[model samples]
Target: MSNTTVKRGEGILSRNRGVLVAFGIIGTWAISLIVLLLIDISQLAIGWRIAATIWQTFLYTGLFITAHDAMHGAIAPSNPKLNQRIGSFALLVYALFDYKKMMRTHWLHHQQPASEVDPDFHNGKFKNFFAWYGYFMFRYWSWVRLFGLMAIYNIISLVLKVPEVNLNWFWVAPAIASSLQLFFFGTYLPHREPEGGYVNENRAQSSNWSVFWSFVTCYHFGYHEEHHEQPNVPWWRLPELHQRKLNAD
Candidate 1:
């Protein structure tokens, strides 16, 4: 396919795909969280509640994945202002994260990857899972964010009279679980040192999982190598590029 053909194809697909998907994910996440918080958990069976938690966790991860796409400017290629505004909104909804801070750090992760300079890396000292995860949390956590979330929780609970049980299970638990899901699949699995060492400039590895599992894991972010190579491809289109890479190899 010529560049002209590819660009034309992308133009058709890109018209409103990213904007729609971004809003869809955000809308779903917000609705689900609200419903879960207000629903009568006592009426639901244990298994059903667990399923709801898992579903919400997936949506929370989707929030971050949407923001990640926006960080790459994949969400709106032609409109910088709209692109970043969406990115900022996604990050705020995700966890009150600072989009500018995260965008800068993410570019560093792409630029230096597994090196010490990378903010997402293990910092060379905390190589184990728990330690590294703690380090990762420490790097991004802020008192302001903490207080902001706490205030939100209190306002919903004390002012709105929502049960703390629902808040804990649906809102807080899913957000924390989503972070673990993202880090374990997207960061640790793809970037950890393989026995043979990294084989490319991106200093990343792609998971050999099937496409379904890859998407389930972290929005195809487990295909980290392809992402580093083609950063402009949106999350929904990663599997296509991954398949192309596999066929060439």
Candidate 2:
């Protein structure tokens, strides 16, 4: 979307469509969670467990990404209260995130991306992934969330003896992996400064790729500029926005 599009109200999404898309993404995520609950990865071969764990991480991140959309009002544009509720629920489901805390910084990120004030972006401050990731966790880490999840795992696994829960494999492992996926694909790639003399605040990975790959990369979030431009558009519509950008180019 462009300035004209925003002014013309073309960027405002259909609430019905937004609600449906929200539920659809949430449904897919729920299915993956149920599958994890049903299967005892403990009995599976080590290789299978690893593969399942990776898949689970992707699903976990999907929920968080959806919540990000909700933060921008893309998930329920016609209803602010509904959008906030959905965003809160999505973040709560995703690693016990605080919706208001995240929204405060995230909106700031949109306002001043790649700048010193951008809470999420490390810019060039950290020399490497390890340094940057460590800083990210430090800034956003929640000790109450940490203990809460630990308590849940212990209660379910130790107290109840639910082998299928496998809290370490099913919960902790995926959340850990999801942190890497979300940070690298969503924050680092898009917000990094573009090449010299080309002044663009946001970058993308949404070229001639299938929607599957686009979503696979980062819930179609790789189209960072389009996302910021049309904050009202949901992740599912980002590729269409990206395609329009390509055609216009």
Candidate 3:
């Protein structure tokens, strides 16, 4: 296939079907949490409190999908409105604050997977004896800084009572912490491509399990190579395109 050849046919709804399902599941879970919160308010049950915490974690995972769609410009049905609404909503939930800026940065990530400029790259490795141990333990400090900024944003928003910013202190702290953890363990850590590493003919197999889960939770982001190869294709059809390339290869 020619580099410039565009693969079409992934419609808005088709691409977003997984996201729509995720929304339904999250909505159900949220409603259950609200009921639990109401019960806790009336009679203060420890079990209810525990359940609420678990549900909150699930909600954060759901927000990942929200961020993914917004980044891909797939949420609002059109480009201009899509970015504004989805970006704003994600910022409100994840305390990201600047979706446009994040999107620009994310584009660079896609452009350079394991290169020095890629903020997500895991650079250090151990020799002979402790190679595996060192590889697993080595973490990227840049990602920590990125998430630290997000946490700071959330704290300031809560302190200031910003409109559209949810002021629930109960979840705010944990949300920030979880978002940071997800950014490291869940996203960047698994996506590092080594120098001269084999690029999988099948894009789906190229990424690690964390990225695969990310694709499920965050639209089709795990199909990283395909997305880089063809940014015009919608998120929903990413897997299909990857499969086609694999078959052709």
Candidate 4:
């Protein structure tokens, strides 16, 4: 397609799709939390609980990615304040991530990817994935906040008659899994050395695989170069942008 065609298509996208999708993801996330709370985990078999927990963990990743889009101003491009508020709340819900702190770190990550300034950078600190992961948590972890979250959940379960197992299966486990997903797929795989890229050293790269696998890997965050170039595109739309680039080439 021609530039005009691309522009027109992007213009249409620039309208309500971002915010609408944001709301939709928010709705799904809210519903998932409610269901997890209401569902009595003790009644289900251990196998079923495990399966359900994994499925819910995937959904939690989606919620976090929606918030990630908002951080990039992909959602509600015309209404930044709205996007900011939504992003903050979305991060808040997903493992109680502090939006402002994340924003600062993320911006730095973009500005100096894989460099010392990038908060996520892990050069010389750890040798392997497990080691790096431990350090990553060390820099950003807040035990006080985590304990408070657990306390609140315990109270909520008492008042609402929700199962503790459900909290473990749905909330706690999923949040932990979500962290691994975000770290492994979104950060580690995309930004690691050699295969992963840096600004001056090696530089991050995108998946050459089909967009399906790319998104499957990490909500199209596997398209790391594309994302770094155009941070404003939502995760759902990264495939389109990648395709458009291919067509232009």
Q: In model 1, which residue pairs have backbone atoms overlapping below 3 Å?
A: none
Steric collisions counted per model: 0, 0, 0, 5
lDDT digits (tens) for residues 71-123 of candidate 1: 99999888989999999998997889999999999999999999999888898
Model 3 bad stretches (over 4 Å): 1-37, 41-55, 123-181, 184-186, 194-220, 232-236
TM-scores for all candidates: the values are: 0.94, 0.85, 0.54, 0.86
List candidate 1 stretches off by more than 4 Å: 1-14
The better candidate by lDDT, 1 or 3, is 1
lDDT of 1: 0.91
Residue-by-residue lDDT tens digits, candidate 2, 1-249: 888977556434443677767677678777876667667665799888788788888888878987898888877777899998888988887778899999999988888776778777674668467787787788888799989877877787777676634667877788889989888877776766556622565433333557788788778877777887878788888999998998999
Full-model lDDT for every candidate: 0.91, 0.77, 0.52, 0.80
The most accurate candidate by TM-score is 1
Q: What is the lDDT for 78 in model 4?
A: 85
lDDT of 2: 0.77
Better of 2 and 4 by lDDT: 4
Judge candidate 1 at residue 8 and give its lDDT.
Answer: 95
Q: Which ten residues in a row have the lowest lDDT in candidate 3?
A: 161-170
TM-score quality measure for candidate 2: 0.85
